[model samples]
Target: MPPQRPAPSARFTPPSRVRAAAFGLLGTVALVAFGLRIGDVAFVDEYAYISQSYYADLFLTGEWNDPAWLDFPGYDLMPLPKYLIGTALRVSNEPRPGPAAARMWYANTHSTFGTPRTLTSARVPSILVGGLGCLALAAIGAMAFDFRVGIAAGVLLMLNPLYALHAHRAMSEAPCEAFLMASLALALAAWRRSFAGRASGFRILGLLAGAGVAAALAVLAKFNGLLALMTIAAWAGLAWAIPRGAGWGWLWFATGSALAAVTAGLAFMALNPYMTARDPVYRVADPADAGPLRPGPLGAWGRFRLLIDHRRAMSAGQQRIFPHNALKRLPERAKVVAVQGFGRFGPFGPATSDSTIRYDMRQDRGAFAWLPLCLGAMGYAMAYGRMQSRRREPPAAWAVAAWALVSLTVVTLYLPMAWDRYLLPIQAPFSLLAAAAIVGAWDALARLAGWKPRLEPS
Candidate 1:
């Protein structure tokens, strides 16, 4: 018996018109999804992100109108979005100085029953960035699988209850993952073009450069943005190990990682002055209690280690405070992953428990639950099957499987508690796979009816 060579996936590529229609529909969904949620203030974490971005600006510029502005309660994550979100709020005329900003935060969150202009402005960046994420996911689906999968996945992501409620908040989820998705999308497209001999060496190198920059920006957006690099690196490492018909060597994947590392290092220093800015001896609270704490500029390597340390401290604190939320055991972790990723009830409020589940369903639950997950399973099965077969398959198809699996496994294993938004790492890939399932069914129905749209190859 001879080994079976897998069929190339370029045959599945939809024509220009179908591709355009898919993108157009996805764009509309992404925009509408973002527009509806830009005004939301239901999530409490929103308070910190806007305030931190505000404080980051003040600290960097040395523009302290009030002494209180020096108390820049820094973010536990990366530094890029501080500038991005701050710039947005500033352009929208967010209240400046320490007290007014504090008052605004307090008014909108704790005491006041009214929505503020600043809250909406603070969230605009998230909404815009999240919208980009939706479109990017759709692109990943179309390029990796089919237009049906791509469109369905994008719509599901845009409208998912957990994604809608948190992904567009003035926080870390959307900005980081969107850029990561872009990097993966670029990698998929480049891999296909290179395999087909449609791209020159220079063009291929350019694509790699773009993917690297996007990956770098993703990391700067958030630390977990490493998922993008990790996915590419994994596929690169595995691609060589697997017996295949034809594809680029794993060295290109190595180049991507190197490029991302270099770009992140350069961009970190360039975009965030805080990396080199001096920190004055400032006490956390009362000047009398404890001593003044000081640290030098968090240079390239230091920042990543510092982030890890901060997260470790956070985990320790969480264990003590939120005793019931720890995922120390396998079953415990599995249950949380299922709830946060597939099920409805999840960690909300200032705490990581659903007891504070005043989070309204009509406002938040915009996506289907069991159906998408089931479809994603079927879709992912097909992708994995293609990769396993001896025949040629799109790198993006295999890469999506790798991305989702790695991310989901990491989340399942490493996530300290059951926070819904932590599922951001795995959501994009899953959504695309779910779309694949739907597309499979649609195509079957079209074939049966003898009126399937003519899907010519590119």
Candidate 2:
């Protein structure tokens, strides 16, 4: 008889059913929470996007080459989310008049939060996208570590007030967060596949391409999302070329990444006609509602010109806000992250709720706030330090380090705002890193306290 195969090791193997159930539960929680008071407020920003969607409908109905009729001055607005909302409106057979259709589109889905009941439908897209963002967080964590870490990260992100607030609103941030995490997950997979072997050529190419596509969508959702793309490039660099590593594998990854970048550029152009259309109109006001419609030059170069013009407009807009000293602002930024993003303790005083929501932070000592943060710090330190000594370090570990580093640098150094919404991208990654530290500490403790049993005669 053939020798019995050695018992399968269960130490590192995770339960699939449990992971699925956790993900499902997390998704449900996200949907419910996001949907609860989503239409509570009709923010000024929402109107901008709704108007853009109306413009999209008109553009879609007009000539392909001369989208001259589709000039909405906020043409500088991110395209994917607006395009998606417009597509949804079209599918629902919204009427022709933009404002009338906009008003009628989100008619009758409201809870008691003082916003217009008709605006409820407008928030639906955000609700759905936000729920999906939770799942994306889970997927990213799991790809980097294990199922438990992923679930923990997802659940923590779901419960966080800052993420939830932006997610529930009909804004660009939710979609941007979702797409950013999706791209990060795909980038991780691409790195894994690219290094596995030449046998994974097609798989590697697909992953890289997918990452590129997702990154493009993220950027189209918000120009700030270019940070995720930068992170991806940085991670690839760290994985290859660094630590005395280089070969055909590195070449393949570089080639795939270059192609992926080109793909992303093409995707951006394809999605945003304002970026490529000739003689496109840049309307600041709805034509039906006493217009600010202005006709611009035509073609691809025209698109670039429009973008530059928009940038100047944005720069002018930014000038109105008072600037804060960066050094003095660091503490304020920390307080926001600790209280709103991470929820270190009871939500009051400095350790308090976010700008939009008044959520009670973790009251218990063992709650997600402190323990996970401490552990995450440990995990980060361990990963960063251990790699120097180890000849062959795990890619996942390094990726996590790189993610935290890149995200932290970008968030703290470049971005002047301390809003929790802007900090959403780092939440899931931090929680996962925390979970890693917790598990690592637990295992170390177990080994220290474990007992050995002597086998007599097997």
Candidate 3:
């Protein structure tokens, strides 16, 4: 009889040093999340959070009843982050009254840097959420690929100064990315379970529901999180295409998709009462009346329309101010995005601005050029592997490739300016790929050098 193969546990496992390295990396990510470059400078957009959060607290939680609550949040397509900003400012308020409530004070006019109390109120949530996002990214890397890959991705993202810059701001990008990564991690887990042949009805549905809910929250945070739709669609598509038991494939997929949609839809409607409004309601700032709000009844469709109209209006205003920003060349935009993907910007050609984040166009950059090198190595490995194996890799491999490359391409096609922060979503997935590439290159070099890898001996 043929010798029985060793059990799975007896085969391969990471060494203690790898575990130690991962923990160390995680510790470093946690440490840097709070202070590095945080409160460096006051951004022009920071003032909106002051007034918006004030109105949010007065309307969302306080007994104060006014139609202005609907209008105070923001003009952007999304509304959930207002609640987070509101809660942060409330914490600042409880610690004794001060200039934290002065709405116009933070408009990049009075101060060059963020003040103590206001910075805490406005940016703490983002800092914590962004730190947690690094954790989720690690999990995504592990689930989608391996533990080493996850750890590397997390470290790379943590080291990315651009991510650090925006993460410390009261912007929608960080939270949106966190939720989007969470959804991807959940979907990956579900895929692994199904691949292992243990996909029970309850297990699959629970995972799908969780993923869907995360996606909904992501979109609520930022329309950029709408990328979650691709993930959800991929799962639903897989359900229909990938074979289940003999004759139940169609029914199983249909049930899961419908159930997940229903559950997530309910959660979304609950989280964003903006969807429940009967007509279109939007906020307009009035310096004379200190930003009075006017809201109309709005339904779900109206909310979506609000997003489109607001984006269009923003585009028009931006074009007037930065006329050269609307570069119509796809190749030029793509080149700019690719460069920013690795945490470098300025186009700095020298880091300046007192090492503080003053302008989105120019700041700390050219730091992670090595990342793209790793990406190139990783791409070579992937291509070589594909050539050697006739079979395709998992669905995630294709999805991630599209996410990193295609998504960047799409974003660039419409990108109005060379803003580095807007590249966060694209950089996120690309970071994962680049981390894998780095590991692959190191292994390749080690092999070439005749260095043996550590293995558990029986």
Candidate 4:
């Protein structure tokens, strides 16, 4: 050097320091995850699940008939996850005398474990699953951006009250989220590697298997899980459509999709004995069972009568009354019931003293508002677009964004009931995108300013 510049001193933080920082960040995320679930009420459908665990045992052991077990229709709605939970209980030291035995044992053991047994015990799986969801989001972010983005995404997910509230509950939403997140992570990684021309056959197979398992698990968790699979299929199709890699990529994707469907079907049949029946007795009844239904005052009463009659007949196994005419009225009657039920109890305005209705409405409206989420989404889109235009986008960024968007759209649009629980699956990703937006915008603004970049000696 002409000026004999002084030797540059090493100013970089040591690898050990970096590792320590990461550990500290993870610890903070863990704290957030733990704190958010504290003091949450088992308010919405919590009892229904608790009751299902109790009754599932009864049905399995032949103590309860199909009709008795079917009284709570939600049990039949998603059978695999609940059944798996029940199986876990049986395998444990918990009593197996009958359907009620698990509940009894749970009651005695819950407090000892530092959580209430009823909803808490049932929620154990969900909590673990939610934690996994956080991890998946972090992986997605890291793979899509950098370690910093991953850690921030994980922290945001842990701190997000929407995710935490549902995670703490004994519901299927958390599990569904876990499966969906995991599937997306793996699929994105596989896609990235495939695009980079580094994916081996084994890697592709492993990724496909993981995706299949995750998608099947999601289906088992909730009917909405099917949306995840659909998203994957679309993503894979599009990825293959681009003249990028070997033709084998499309074959691999198709195989994975078929395997997922088969796994899901098998899991459903194995868990739900009812599916095997050629002619299941309790098929969703036709609208004609209710009679000729009109929307006016007299017609409404006629529809109500038809509904009552149908219920009575189903309960007593009698011939369906008003079969033909009632069928036409059923749709109108259902609409009326849904509207009345929601208006009377839904949280469109202020909270009420009626505990059940108040809680139900609050939970529904709180889940549906999406105001905070929408803000975060806007932030993510801006950041994502900028990264793409700048040619600084990570390999998996598009995949993760697509996956999140598809999952959110499916749940918000396809599902009939938009309960707060339905929003749980998207919460983790939403938090990630929100954090990315904030950090990316801040960095962009800093760059726009006259701030000089400094590089520490490595």
Best by lDDT: 1
| Model 3 C-alpha lDDT versus the unseen true structure | 0.59
Per-model C-alpha lDDT, please?
Answer: 0.62, 0.61, 0.59, 0.52
- Give one digit per residue, the lDDT tens place, for model 4 in 329-400: 444333322332223222232232232232344433533434344456555755564454244222345555
- Pull out the clashing pairs in model 1: 5-391, 6-390, 6-391, 6-392, 149-435
Best by TM-score: 1
Q: How many backbone clashes does candidate 4 have?
A: 10
**lDDT of candidate 3 over 1-458, digit per residue (tens):** 32223222211237769766776669466547655656566665655554455445544664233444354343443656666776777766633222233333434334322346666567777787778778888877665555677787887777665666667787777788888888777766665454333346567668768877987888778777767656556565654564333334334444565665676677776676555543333446455433234345565666558666777677667767666555456776666565554435321223222313322344335534544564674575355334322232233444455456545655786776656556667767777877767676676798899995664422
Superior candidate under lDDT, 3 versus 4: 3
lDDT of 2 by residue, 1-458 (tens): 32222222212335567667878988998899889876565765676566556556645665444543334433556667666666656666553235443333334222122125335666777888888888987787666655655776677677665567777676788888888888888878777555433426667678878888988888888866776678778876866754423234555566677767877778877776666555534445444532235445556656656666765565444434524312235666554445444453211123233343333443222245554564466466456435432423234656766777777666665434444455666665665676666655655686688932221210
User: What are the models' TM-scores?
Assistant: 0.80, 0.75, 0.77, 0.62
TM-score of 3: 0.77
Which pairs clash in the backbone of model 2? 71-281, 71-283, 73-283, 278-298, 278-299, 279-297, 279-298
Decreasing lDDT order of the candidates: 1, 2, 3, 4
The per-residue C-alpha lDDT of model 4 at residue 15 equals 64
Provide backbone clash counts, one per model: 5, 7, 5, 10
Residue 442 miss distance in model 2 (angstroms) = 4.0
In terms of TM-score, how similar is model 4 to the real structure?
0.62
What lDDT tens digits, residue by residue, belong to model 1 across residues 210-316? 77788877877777788877786676665556554443444454565566557656765555444555446533555432212323444546745665676778787
**TM-score computed on alpha carbons, candidate 2:** 0.75
Clashing residue pairs, backbone N/CA/C < 3 A, model 3: 277-298, 278-297, 278-298, 279-297, 279-298
> Which 10-residue window of candidate 2 scores lowest in summed lDDT?
2-11
User: TM-score: which is higher, 2 or 3?
Assistant: 3
